[model samples]
Target: MPDTFQRLYELIDTPRFAQGGVPRITTRKSAEDFAPRDEGLDVLLINTPVREWSYPNVLPIGQGYVAAGAIMDGHRLTRLDLNADRRVPISTLDPGYDAWLFARLDEALAGEPDVIGIGGIITQYAQIKKICAYCKDKLPDVPIVLGGGVASAMPDFMLKHLPVDYVSQHEGELTFSEILHRIEMGASMQGVAGVTYYETDSHGERTAIRRNPPRRTMTAEQLGHMPWPLRHLWDIENTYRVNPVGHLNQGRKWNQGAPESGGKFSAEMIASRGCPYTCEYCFSDYLGTAYRSRPPADVVREMEYLHYEYGVEYIEVLDDLMLTSYKWALEFYAELHKSGLPKRGVEWGGTCRTNILANDIVRAAREGRGNMLELGHDAGLRRVAYGVETGSPTILKVIDKSGQTPATIKTAVQETVRVLGYASCSFMFGSPGETAETIRETVDLCIEMDYRPEVFFFTTAYPGTVFWQLALDKGLIRKSVDGTVGPADDGIIERYLMGLGEQGDAVRTNFSDLPDDVLLQLTNQAAQDLNSHNSHRHPYQDGAPNSIVRDATHATI
Candidate 1:
């Protein structure tokens, strides 16, 4: 909270204001605060801190926090469950929070954990930097290992910039556990695959950096059997300020009935890993494109634990692709049914692709009691909104999205109405080959599909994707971010790029046929025509961090 800093500012400024001059008093660390600290503690894992301004949710818990569960692969989604078991003691903490939150960090750090693992995403760079800087300042000898989406996205960037000791990309289960083991046993990281670190100068500035080739992606079996996340490692309940019963929520509403403690408990989980199909704009597209599915039994078991143990009556699956394999869907349905987990276990939804939703697949997904499937703008158009990125097949082919032809896309969107019961669609305005004629083609396509426009996402080039290279070649993104510091407000770049991803003005386009002003007008026209459906549901009603989600739908599930 800002209360602490605000009060200090007042105390110092009050004196200066009395004399009608600016306060020249400087604030320095107290003797006790700046005292020498021990860096030879045990293991400490951190989930970088967050605030409401940075992350808008019904609750203020940070995103990418589920790294513990991720390290366990898709099998476990919450950490509180992991700490209950005999596992590694790298307790996760979000100490960069309020005063009370700092207390929780103090308790976790009281053990003086020597190895610290910090989990973060791209948008949390500034916060992660602040946390790592503080940790190094206090415990200079301890090794701070950074991992998570941002690390996975750009391992070299983190190694070159942040004051971290080590960084790991991609799946961290094998590598992180190995790193921890070596540190505990007094070994070296020279042979560790998927690790990067900097050789720093005496002043803590990076002098040299070395990164190893990433380890191969985990096998399907490896992902399914990993241990659960160590949620017990952190005081999450108090840290997130969770008020499950009633709080501002984004996206779909989950009717979890009534919360045991007025909706005080909730969680987000991932049931699968990677996506089968490749889209140029996906952040992780640059990483290998192969996808993996967790065993259904393992997925259900995680759900069972959360529903019963954490009192998480509602859950949301945050997966790359929640529905793909028909065989897996059938097995998953059987597991959920046979397990006899309460209705709470199935109250969820996840993103699906256009080609994954066959009749049998949809039928199997609907077997759950409280499940739902939400489609991304570039998803399988069944009951969800069709992703009509552009009307022109020429543009589609140019962007290497020939998979979404007029026939295939229209048929899917039309069939979805009966199979899933509602229709929403997403469109993109600017890309490599967008032109006036292409824009018209998109508008006409929306008319044909009867698309209920949800939101228009003006796409950008994320670092690991093919689009990133294209953007670079075309001068869209000019400079490399390795040595450069990002905006002081880490969220600025993400917010500016996505521009309220659900609904807002599009970001700058790199289209060839039209200027940005013309592209804007064409996009607006297409949006109006697509959203012209009389029954178009409000997009905000189906945004993120909802009450519950499912792989398919509420009526069928």
Candidate 2:
């Protein structure tokens, strides 16, 4: 065995030992695990395996929400979290990994569900494609539905290429329930809002595609009233055991700070959905630009459950932009403090914007002794990551990071470091007009703030973002001379999506004006400079000297 796999096995015993050292083949739990109602449609929700090496697996909360909505509307649901069932180390690197995944899928389909729904992000495009094809072959008559960001972003392309019968667009809880209701009633998908389906001929040949009107974004009240995620369906214990801390809190001292709690285990949750900002590189607009958050009380209730039931000592809030509304942030912190989770040793982290953090500091100064950071610490906010994507003003405008300038970025980082003990800032290279000088500015900004730079990512053009369209317009995403990129050119798009799963620090596609080699060299040099500058820093948790501890960084736009 390779040293990496051997070490992982020795450390965690994650891989099962079998004859000839092959990992055991594990399948989803049998249908007997869930009792389906006779009157409702039998819906199977498949949580396809993501790139596990990219980050540790968490309960698929997005699919959990979908399952919650289905059950609420009188539908029988069976969930298959393929990401959780792997019994092998470095499974994706193994040649038989795809076959093993298919075997698990086949076993899950043994009941022959009435309808199948697959949810994943764009990076899982290849895996999802294989899954959809396998399902079509095995259960030819069963209708397949696709949801989540991947389907919502490029509904037409997905409908034309994949074997999906319908693409459930944004905020899938309501739209998915409506899809199930229609399916149960044997109704046409014509007027179902927030969906993309095909119009078929008499012989069931797809003739054209019909995209229904977009659904209105859900309100905060509606989000609060939605069912709590069906976390019971997943192996929460195994998840906690195998990967205790999420990418955001990897090397933080808090992971080991709470010795009184015995040991630390982590889980991820989202307090809000949809980002209000329109950063050109992001595809969050697929769910609409309205920023809605669940009630603070409701959010705290869930946290309490995780704490008392699952012993989750750490939480990673996966909000797109957690600090969009300062009023909402304050309310959440107040509720969290009132719940006393912090006293019980629960610490959470989330992504934040520099403009919001800077403005919050200003408000704190005006209100009292500028104890906002201290108050948050008391409420269990351990880490706050800011997306200072670029230091150059020109690149900032190009990426449409509204209200963020170099001055604001500096102020936010310096203030966060002074008040919170440490600050985390993530930077990206290879914007549309990126140059060596812009890269230098970003590096200089990092040095000036005395913050150790995490990984620097190349700006990737995901399918539904403005960057994707720019790549197409600039002939980066190629098409035929006739100016049509259809199913025939599926390979072109598929290759690009596959490339997205590669290491982020490496150049994927050079959107910058600089040559590819030059861009790579600059990015590497910037990483080294930042690391060398902060080499002496040490991790600080409670009442320790503030410094940026080395932590694993993941790409976030």
Candidate 3:
């Protein structure tokens, strides 16, 4: 869930994929060249697919990056991203499909790896268990270990319900290493601090709920000790295609003049882990509550590496809150400027608060080479949504997002426009206390901001957010979108099956207390008003990155 690989790479003496400390392996089709034979290899495979319904998004692609990096550190990984290989015939949610998945597993194991480790973000537990069962059945001797964001969130539930041999809780880098070392030494798993295991009672029935005591949370320094995620393990260039709604795939056409225009040399880099903002709708709070940042020097070095090796032109810091500290931002930008890298102007973007747009930060972001920003202005009725579930400040307070408000948000938006000439604003619909009128206010706010020639929009609530919880509690979510509620786990598929476009109800909100037509009309009108500027197209060379051509470049106050 967090960037574990980035930290490890930071600790490395040299961060090259082909360097000596890392494992040597080929990703994608290259691995297939080896004759199929079980080498009796012991591997630790982590699956990141969050849910069964999420299968369409999983494929070995992303996991391969992590696994490949570990393999460079002398670990073997059988990465699985079910989203990538959609052609597989079996259903991921069906426990009966283990036989089918195992066939591929066996081919990979090929007697090469003696053990297989699996980890994921929780929702995939059912599917992961089926795979675990298959491993036990085929290679009964191999150990199956599980750990991930989900393991940390629901360790007890995972231990009890799944066939997973061990569940590593909290940050997995250290624990995973400990587990692997113990395995290599053939040590007992009983004393591992982050592990949970089961032992049969004298009655021969599953009885005891055994667990290792809690351990300390990992620090950024500690995290920096691991290997950089092995990007070589994945088909990095092709990963954009794995997701149906992946932004890269949206409106993408290959071989077109617009498509060929690659954006600046900026690379998406992780400067820190954990978000300080506790918006209930985020999983970050569920996994980590504190904020941590990598040392600035380490970050600058990575940038230097990017410039020398990859010809990267700019940087996109992928932190949840890159602007959490003004001092950190200033220092990082200053250090980066001195890295002796190419002076190619760079553009960066991230989620930040309007409060951070102080003159100094704006100057650095605008003239200092950082441009483009994403501000989360969840609702215009921030207050009511907090208490009465309206966009009132009171409502925002109730939802624990009091930091967002129209005044402060407006200042932030204006600051971006003042300094960078443009920025993006995100408003979440279906929030508590929300109604058509409140939504219209938000729409009106977007229209007002539209004059700056920025972006505006809404996104459906994905499962696992606090917003979804509220939706469920409000009975706004139901089974079989005929607008009826039912009692059942609803299997994750049904929970997310609002069927949006597929059911001809894409524009309909399940929050039935409000008139459906009214809600749709307001939402549509807001979108229409916001998009009014899209027709007055800015003259941009087709493939240019959206950031560089905008006024945000020299708009700083």
Candidates in order: C-alpha RMSD to true structure: 16.4, 12.6, 11.2
lDDT of 3 by residue, 1-557 (tens): 54243222333334452243433333233333333223223574645333222213223322443454345435545555443443222234355444545656676667556566676544455556667776677766677777665566556666766666677765455566566656665766677767777756677466776788755554565434433344434333443222322122113211110222444333345567777766655566423456887666666666665455445444445456656665665556666567644344433445566545544445556665443232211100010001111234543554576456655555566655655445544444444456666676665555565532222222233345665566656555554344656433554334344232211124323443455544444544544456522212211224231211222111111
Backbone clashes under 3 angstroms, per model? 27, 0, 58
Candidate 1 runs further than 4 Å off: 1-41, 49-112, 199-207, 232-266, 285-289, 341-345, 358-388, 423-426, 479-513, 524-557
393-469 per-residue lDDT for model 2 (tens digits): 98999999999999889988887777667676667888988999988888888878777764466787788888887
| Worst 10-residue lDDT window, candidate 3 | 379-388
List the candidate 3 regions with Cα displacement exceeding 4 Å. Answer: 1-41, 44-74, 78-106, 119-141, 159-163, 185-191, 202-205, 211-214, 224-226, 237-267, 345-347, 358-395, 417-421, 451-512, 515-525, 532-557
* lDDT of each candidate versus the true structure: 0.50, 0.71, 0.47
**Which scores greater on lDDT, model 1 or model 3?**
1
| Number of the predicted model whose TM-score against the real structure is largest | 2
The alpha-carbon root-mean-square deviation between model 2 and the true structure, to one decimal in Å, is 12.6
Tens digits of per-residue lDDT for model 1, 440-555: 88777767766565556555556567776676565554322222323222333333332222223234335465665565555555555565431122221222212111222111
Write the number of the candidate with greater lDDT, choosing between 1 and 2.
2
Off by over 4 Å in 2: 1-36, 87-93, 240-242, 252-263, 369-371, 479-489, 502-505, 532-557
As a TM-score, model 1 comes out at 0.65
